[model samples]
Every structure is written in C-alpha cells, then in structure tokens.
Target: MSTPDNNWEDHWRETLADHKASPPSTMDWGGMEELLEAKVAPLSPIKAPISSLEGKTLKLPGLPWPVWAIAIALVLALGYWLGSHTALGVSQEMNTIPKKTSLADALTPPADTIFDTLFSVGANGELTEEIISIERAIVNRTTAQKSPEINTSLPAGKSPSPSTPVNLNREKLKAGSNDIAPSTTPAVLLSEAKAPTTSPEFFTGIRRPDTPSSAPGLSYDLSSKPTVRPNRGGYVRPLKTLSPPTDRELLEQRIKALSLSEKLVITPLRYKNGHFPAYRPRN
Candidate 1:
C-alpha cells in the first residue's frame, strides 16, 4: 500500500521531470552588451595648463610693505601721544589739589618761637615762675569758694569754724612742675596733690588677708604618704602569649611553597620542536 508521503514524493518527481527551463523572450542581450562595453571603456586623462605660479610661490593678498610700515608708525605715534597726554593730565591734577595739614602741625607754635625758647635761658625760669603763680591762684580760688559754701550750709547761730590751711611750697612745686613739664596741666597737678595716695593692692585684685581663718584644732599632714589598700579579688589570668599567623604571612608562605614546588617540578614545553605546528582552527 502506497503511503501519502510516498505518493507526494512520486508526484513531485513527475512534475520536476516535465518542468523545462527556457530563456525569457522580453530580455535584450544587445542592450546589455552595449552597457557592459560602456562600463569597460577607459576614461581620458585630464591636462592642467602650466602658468607662472607653477615655479613661483603664491603670496597672500594684503596691503603693500610700505603701507604696513606707515600703519605701524601711526600706531606707535598714537600710543606715545596718549601716554604723554595721560601723564601730563595726572601731573596737572596733582598740582591742582591742595596739600593737607595735620592737627599737630596746626596747633604747634612757630619755628621762630621754638628757636627763641630753646636758646633763651631765662625762658625756662620765667615759665616755671608763671606756672607756680597760676597753681597758687587756682588753690586760693578753690579754698575761697569752699569756705562760703561751708559757712552757708551751717546753722545761722553757729559760727563757721576755720578750715585747715593749704600748704604751698615753692621748691616742691618747682620740682614737680619741672618733672612733668608740658605733659601735665596745672589743674591736673593740683587734683593729684589733693587726692589721697594708697597702695595698688588696696584697690585692685583679690585680697588674700580678708579670707577667714581655719578651725583652731583641726590640723592636716600634707607631707604624709597616701595609704594603699590590699587587693581582695581573685587572681586574673594573663593573656595568651602565642599569636596566630596573619593572612599576609600565610599567603606569603603559600607562595614560597608554590615557588619551591614549581622549581622542583619539570613542566613540558608547549612547543618542544621550537616551532608551532600548523593546524586548521575550529570555527
């Protein structure tokens, strides 16, 4: 009995046997031959005309050398003119501005007066005598003003008592005036003389004497040594003395062992004949 697959194979064989391969009638072989001839033909060589530029160098188009020289000169002249003009303007501005004077210069006496005072011997004595007289006048005026106030403040029936007399020594005043000179005024000297003087410690910093005293009988031995108590706890075990090898040391030892083993072993060479054998590579 013929199966469907066998029947299909037999029908395909008969159909293939009857099939014929014939050329197409519409094909133009003559046109195709002409196109092939055209493609195969060689092209003609192009010829360039020889000119003066063939041997000579081509220059860039720009201004002439003389024109360039003139332009550079003009630029330099303009720069010079600008620089001189700016410098002149700055000088004029500086000259037009006024010079400033300091407070010390304005307050200072004339050079002539300074020269006269420095050279003249009588000037010093006269200045000292004048200062002393001024101080005396000030002291007398202050005392007089205070006396009236004190009397007015007291009861009408009660007589105002005479106040202590102010002592003014010429030698002491002269010494003090000579020592301080122009730095201290007469009023300041009088004030300093009137104010009571005291030790620096009285007004500033901590007062150590004012602190309260310690209790009478309680005494402390600062020089005595401190007592130490005995340890009552159990004895502590000491730490292990042996330390394990680190990873780096282990790896180094492993590498050393591997190197020694590699030296002992004889490995076969890839190309014992000193030349690679030719073989087809697998795709």
Candidate 2:
C-alpha cells in the first residue's frame, strides 16, 4: 500500500496535466457589460431662469435743465470780464511813473522872510560875539604854551606888565577863522594828507616794560619733548585645508552613492544643425 502524501502528489500531477490540455475554457464575462454601460452614462444638467431686469429700460427722476444752463453761462461771462480788467489795470500802473528829483534842492533854505528870520547867512548865525571871544581865548592859551616868547615891543622891552595894551592883528584873526571853519565842518585835511608825528606830551602817562614778568606759575616752557611709542607684535594662525582620500575610502564612498531615479532624456537628429529634439521619459 502507498502513503497518503504520495497519493496527494499523484493527484496534483494529474490535475496539472488536464489543465495544460484544454485550459478550462476561459471565464464567461459578457454578463458585466450592462453594469459598465450604466456607470459610464452622465446625468443631464439643471437649467436656471434668467433675471427680469434683462432687456429692460433704466428709469430716473426728472431734472431742471434750463436752470443749470443759465448758471454755467453767468460764470463764464464773469470770468471773462475779470481777466480783461486785471490786465488793463496792471498796464496802466506800469506806464504812468513819477519823475525823480534831487534831495539837495528840496533841503535848500527858501529866499523868503520866514526863512531869513530863522536862519542867518554865514558864520553869523553859528557863532555869537561871546562864542568868538571864548574861541579866541582858547587859541591864545594854546599858542602861549607852544611858544615861550614875550608879546611886548618896547625898544628893548624895559619890562612887560599886565596893564600893557596888546594889539590884535586882522591877519591873525582871518587865519584863525579859516582854520576853525574847516575843522567844524569836516576832517578834510586828515583825508587829503597824513597826520604829523605826535608830541612827547601826548605819551606822558604811558610806559614800556623792561623785562618779562617772573611771577610764580605765570610762565610755561614752549620746547617740544620727544614721544616714545610702543612696538606691537603677535603670531597669526594659518587656515586648514583638506587632505587627499585613501584608495579604500574612495571605493567605499562610490559604492554608498549608488542610486536609481526617473529622468528625462532627449535624442538629437543627425541631419539638423541647431534644432535638436523635445524631451522624453527614460522609464
């Protein structure tokens, strides 16, 4: 008698042989065609009604057209009148100018009795008898101080006294009057000529120093001193660079980098010059 395992193996061999001979007639799939057609058919779309406002005329309230037209006309007329008058006014103001006159002529004294009573003719109005006497006294005192000569004439001058009669010369008075008049008016001589050397009397109160002040904390040494600067030096670290890899490490790195990916590849035409081709997938 044979074992059950052997029997089962023999049964499977027979089944496989029968299948290879006729192949089980191919399954009947014609019944599923109706289900596929039903799934493929699309549904009809829903329709909506159009709005009532379409194809209709727009409505608005009535307005007064005549009033607006009159207001626009009035504004245009006023602007035209104002523009014409402004140009005419400016031209008239610029064309009619007044003449110029001298200030000296306006300030001159009038030849009437009113002006004559207020202002007299030459030095008479400016200086009275008393003022003249005062000026003469000042001039005499200055002359006496400058010149020490006596003013008496007596053969050999027996003696001069306060009671002696002094003669006043007209030439001296004329020269003094000319000098005083010019001095009161302006410094005309100072502008025309250089000033003379001042007398010793003018510098009587001023004095010069013989030596510099030697007071404590009052002087400073102006000489320059030499500066000593520090000399700085230090060491700088160099930058690091990569060394070449060993043969074993290089092989291991290449093997670890192996990979697969989907990419696009193109084929060039052998006959075309600049027109190659479009891209295609290399799958």
Candidate 3:
C-alpha cells in the first residue's frame, strides 16, 4: 500500500521473525530428513527381481529331493488322516444297547406301605379301623397258637381215664408199618410209559433218507443238481483246467495265498538212526 522507504525490508524481516512460531514435531524438516535417511531407510545395493520357480531346479540348501517328497507325503498322509477323521468321525458302538423293558417293569405300580396295605377304604372316602382290629386279632390268635407252654397245658389232665382210653391190636400194628407198605405193580407198566408218542414230520434236518428213517433229518431242494463236485472220475485234471472257483472258493484262495507264498524252513529229512537221502523229484 505504500512506497519503499526508510529501510523497511530489514524491519519487516525482524517483525516476521519475532511473530513466527517454532517448528512442530511432525513438521521438523531436519529431524524428518534425519529419520528418513538413517532410521527409516538406509541406501543399499539394489536387489535383482526374483525369478519364477516353475522352470527352475529347486535347490533346497541341504535337503534332498526324497526329503521334500517325504515331507509332502507326510503332509498328504496327515491331511488324509485328518480328512478321514472328519468325514467318518467316531465309530458308533453298541455302548448304550437298548434295554429290553418289559410291560411288568414299565407299567407296574409302586410298592405300598404297611399302613396302606392293611387299611380298609370305604366308597364314602372314609378310612375304617375295622381292618386294623381284624388284623390285630389274627396276629394275637397266631401268637397264642405258636406258644408251646399254652398248647401243652390246655387239656389239664396228664393221664387218660379208663373210660376215655382206646385199645389197638398188636397184630394190626406190626402188619401196617411205614417202610414196607406192600403195594402190587406189573412189570409191563414201564415199557408202555416210555413208547414214542409221535409218528413223523417231513423236512427235519440236513440229511433226508430216500426211504423214511425212524428219526427224520434236515431238508433241502433234493431235486436240484449238486453244486459240490464229488467227481465220478478221480482227480485227473490239467493244472490250467483246475475248477473255476466260486466266491467262497476265491475267499479260501485269498486266505491260502499267505501260506502258499511262505517258504518252509529247509530242514533235512532225519530218520531215527541218521539223515535220510533225498528222494527223486518224480516220486
């Protein structure tokens, strides 16, 4: 607004310096530059761009190819094991087998107390003591009858009078003794009691006779041809033409495979006296 005069430049600079604020922490140019250069980033050799791993031969510092393969295989195996555990989960066992509950066990009423058992109930919903008195009387009668002193002393007199005595014949006493009662029985009674009561029912067990047997056997479709080959000719077949196996035969073959492959211990044939000489292969 005014012309340059009276050395105003130096005064303006002094006034701005007096009013100007100090640098803030974030805006400190010297500190920021120091930090950027020393602490934040240090200049080094420029690294080359990393190449793709697909085509390159992977050279792990010391580990061999099989080690990597083993590691991968272990990882895969672990993954498979984990996957299988997750997929199948734990096997359900019959740990809690269903208890066979009977109708008697399920529907039965709880056992009653002695008071409930003996007491009499009227239709008018009143509890009567009549049943209690009757029970008490029965108990008293039982107690009285069981006592020996009361029973023995009931009739008073120790000896019977001549008028009350009853006489027994000595001959009748000897003839009717306990051990030898002498009852008559026929000999044929035993055989008649043991005779078989049944006639016969067909289809009993695995072997049925053409003519009916005294005891029946098991049943099958007897009309069908035999699956088992008990041959008319002897066992004279070529090695190649050996019978085509059934599934059961295959299972038997699978079972025998372990034994067939197994080599017997090469033991020399020993006799009672000495070692026996080797026989001819054809024999």
Which model scores highest in lDDT?
1
What does the lDDT read for residue 151 in candidate 1? 14
Error of 3 at 266 (Å): 88
Candidate order by decreasing TM-score:
2, 1, 3
State the lDDT at 225 in candidate 3.
Answer: 31
**What is the C-alpha lDDT profile of model 3 across 1-283, one tens digit per residue?**
4456845877887899889686576658877787777866567767555544546786768888999899999999999999888666443334445444785454433333121112222223222221112112121111111100001111434422212222222122221122422121111121123222343332222211211111222111112332332322333232323222222233345435534433233344565246676666885
TM-score of each prediction: 0.18, 0.19, 0.16
What lDDT score belongs to each candidate, Candidate 1 first? 0.37, 0.32, 0.34
Check candidate 1 and list the clashing pairs: none
* Stretches of candidate 2 exceeding 4 Å from the true structure: 1-62, 89-182, 185-193, 197-283
Error of 1 at 281 (Å): 99
Between prediction 2 and prediction 3, which has the larger TM-score? 2
Order by lDDT, highest first = 1, 3, 2
The segments of candidate 3 whose C-alpha lies over 4 angstroms from its true place after superposition are 1-18, 21-59, 90-283
- Report how far residue 108 has shifted in candidate 3, in Å: 24
In Å, residue 249's CA in model 2 sits off its true spot by 99
Candidate 2 has its poorest 10 consecutive residues by lDDT at 208-217
lDDT of 1 by residue, 155-267 (tens): 34542221212232223222222344422533223333433243332333221110111111111121221121123133333232322232223334644554454342233
